[model samples]
Target: MKRAGTHRSDSERIDLTVRDYGLDGGIASAHTVRKRRIRRQTRFLAGLAILLVLTAGGIWLIKSLSGNTAPTTESSQPTTRPSATTAATVTPHPTSTPVPTPVPTTTKPQLSAEERQSLLQQAGDEVVHYLDQVTTGRIGIYFQNLVNGESWAHNDKMPFVAASSIKLGINTYLYSRVAAGEISLDEVLRYDNRAYPTGDYEAGTGTVQNLPNGTELSVRETSKLAITISDNCATNMIIRRLGGIDAINPWLNKISGIVDYRQKVSYTNYAGQSQNGRHRTCARDLGLQAVRLFSLWQENPQVYAPLIEDLSHTEFDFGIKQGLPEDLVVAHKIGTNGAYATENDLGIVFAEEPFVLCVLTEMASAERARKIQTDIAAIFYEKVASWPWP
Candidate 1:
């Protein structure tokens, strides 16, 4: 009999007659064929199971390499399965990249030399035209635009009586001494009969003269009186303290554009005259002095602030200060000599665009000179108000 659960080829079936002859004419059984077909089916099912296992392993390897997790299925379980609760609660994160912030930029406009000169000339002509119509005095004016550094002048070389304006130079000398540590503001000086003689007592602009003869005032207080009130007695006291005109003139000469600065004022007179001669200054020099003082105010406010403060409180403002808006600040000095028929004002206008302006007049009455000064100042203010300030 043929073996059970065994398969045979077609050739073998064809040769079954020979085999049957050898087997003494035996025939194959149906039970043996059925058993052989069942065995083949079992082998095929095992091969399909192995193929599914290999495919699953390959998918898991690909997911791990790509930094991802393979999905779990209900029908198949991996070596380790995430808890159903953990997998269900997972939330996806956004992958958007961060952006950078932007920076701000600024733009500044520049002026040309030609344009600056043109503006300066136009302003100069306007000032000259207005001043010519107002007074018959010999006027000297110097103007400087603090912003653009443009300058204009009329009769700048001419010299006129310094009058009380010499107090500016006096105040500057005192401050210079203080800055050099040669003197102290707190140091006191006596207002005695020797310094202010009762016989030669000047009745001009200060209260210090009326005080008791031996009353003591600090260098600080004396300087304030000289500038704020245009006090002749206080000025003479400070001049005497500084060793008279000989000592102060050299300091004034060091300033640029200053041609003539001489004479010490007598207590009996507001005019800056002595045995030496009358003190003289020009518009150009006064304007430059104002510029220097402004620079000092900017560079060393603690040391120079009091001088500017006293100037701001100047009680005589019938000139430049009269023309400006009441809200504006002007650090200036005014000089008037009724005997000489001279009136002048020199100062820095602290406006939207700050500037230095000096107006000096000679051979004119006080009333006419002041009117001319006011008109000239008003014209400058108008021009500056129109300019585009930075």
Candidate 2:
């Protein structure tokens, strides 16, 4: 049995030991049984080791084929989303991000070119009808919508007596000077006989008017007086301050092509003699002045807005403001001469889209001129009121 155990085949030795060492064996048999028992234990242990090796290989092969090597342990659970990266221990993966839903919006109405033209033509027809009805004198009208820059005119290019309507030009130059820093609103001006002479600008007309003649007024105060009350003396002083009427014409020529009167023909320019045809303007010229003024203010509000603001509060609103709601802010200038029977109103009407309107009338009664202007303005305003235009 000893020779077969180690120096012989293991199966043969196990057989010999089991046969010789029966259940009732002697002391020698006991030793053989112990050896046999040890052999059985060794065989069982060997089988278990082989089975363990096979189980470990199977786990590795499954992990490789599935493209995952993370152990079934705490190391596999990540704290954050695993990135698409390979690591020495475990290869990681990326997860998808979700999308969100959107909301909607809105817009405004717009006018086509043909549609806008029709509206303008309708307004023009009404203007002509009203103008034809009144044959007492001549009437010229100008209108422009600031939004689309569309304009309509009737007898706009013909010359008309530029009554106080010329004041708009004079004051515009003053403001331009102020804008250039050549003049200041705060600077003091003399309303003396030199600028406002004895018969000039009605220095001799009223005691109240005469009182302020030799007195000093600020440039601001003078400008306000010129437009608000159509003060001739105040206008003369501004003309003087701006270095005479000749100095104002170059700027006027650029805007209107018509200049101020050369010789006085009426009481409006009581200070100077008026020239009728030689010093005349069309509705277009006056309308252009306000349009230019408005444009300049839009470009530089700090320097020129004061002119618009001052004109907005004029004391004389008879021609353009007649028959209109008091709430409509009309920044305008009016000139009327009973001798020439001329009534003129030129202004920037602050509508939803502010516009310029200049109406000049001659040889007509003041009452007639006023009615025509109001009616013409109403026609345009009616159309402008509904213009939430492009």
Q: Tell me, by TM-score, which candidate is best.
A: 1
lDDT of 1: 0.74
Between which residue pairs do clashes occur in model 2? 164-335, 200-271, 201-271, 263-273, 263-274, 263-275, 264-273, 264-274, 265-274
Worst 10 residues of 2 by lDDT: 96-105
- Cα lDDT tens digits, model 2, 112-147, are 766766788899998888777874667778888766
RMSD of each: 22.5, 20.8
What digit string (tens of lDDT, one per residue) describes model 1 on residues 1-390? 878967788788658845444433344544455577789998899999999999999998887877655555665644476788868997765222111111111222144667767767887898878776765657899988776667889989677777887688679878878888998999998775454433213667778778777678899998999999987778877877888777888777777535567643222122333323457777888788887777666666677878887887788878987888776777889998776777989987876667888999875468877877787888788876775534
Q: Model 1: which residue pairs collide?
A: none
Q: Which regions of candidate 2 deviate over 4 angstroms?
A: 1-109, 194-208, 258-277, 388-390
TM per candidate comes to 0.66, 0.65
What TM-score, to 2 decimals, does candidate 1 have? 0.66
